[model samples]
Target: MSAPDTNLEKQERRHKPSMIALRLVIAFAVLALVGFVALQMLGSGDPIAEELETGSAPSAAVD
Candidate 1:
C-alpha cells in the first residue's frame, strides 16, 4: 500500500479580501465624493444656500 503525504501542515493559505465588501466600500466612497462635489459645485440651485463659506471679510467701520 502507498503511504499518504503528511506535509499538509506546511502549506500556506492565500489571503484575499471579500469582493462584495470591497465593492461596497468603493461604491460608498465614490458616491460620497460625488455628492460632496455636486453640493459644492451646483450649490443645489440655491445660490445663497448650501454655500458653506470660509475665510474672513473686511471689517466694516461704524462712526
Candidate 2:
C-alpha cells in the first residue's frame, strides 16, 4: 500500500462552501419544513410560511 509520489497534480477548491455553511443550510431547511408542517397542523392560520419564504431565519455565509 503506497501513494503515488510522481509529479502530483495540484487540486484547488473553487466556489466551494464551508462545512459550517453547509450545516446551516441543512439545519435551516429542516427547521423550515418542520415549522411549516407544525403551522399546518395548528389550524390557527399562522404566518410561519412568511418567515420561511422570506428567509428570515438566522444564517451566515463563510468565505
Candidate 3:
C-alpha cells in the first residue's frame, strides 16, 4: 500500500447571467417564430368551420 497525496482541491462553480439571458432570449424568440408559422399555416379563418366545410369532422373541441 502507498501513502495518499495531500493535494486535494475543491472547485466553486459560477453562473454567468449574460449567457443565461442570451439563451433565454433565443429560446423565446424561436418559440414565438414557430408559433407564428403554425398560425399562418392554419390560415385566417374559423378552423372548425373550415374543417366542416371540407366535409371532415372537426378535430378540435368547440367551446
Question: Which is the leading candidate under TM-score?
Answer: 3
Colliding residue pairs in candidate 3:
none
Question: Residues 16-62, candidate 2, lDDT per residue (tens digit)?
Answer: 45656889999999999999999878775545665676779635455
State the TM-score for model 3.
0.47
lDDT of 1 by residue, 1-63 (tens): 765855544432221346567898999999999999988786566433434353344345568
Which scores better on TM-score, 1 or 3? 3
lDDT of candidate 3 over 1-63, digit per residue (tens): 864754334211234566688899999999999999999897768877677778898676789
Prediction 2 TM-score vs. true: 0.43
Ranking by TM-score: 3, 2, 1
The reply for model 1, stretches above 4 Å from the true place, is 1-17, 44-63
Of 1 and 2, which scores higher on TM-score?
2
lDDT of each: 0.63, 0.68, 0.75
- TM per model? 0.42, 0.43, 0.47
Question: Relative to the unseen true structure, what is the C-alpha lDDT of residue 28 in candidate 2, on a scale of 0 to 100?
Answer: 100
Error of 3 at 62 (Å): 34
On lDDT, the leading prediction is 3
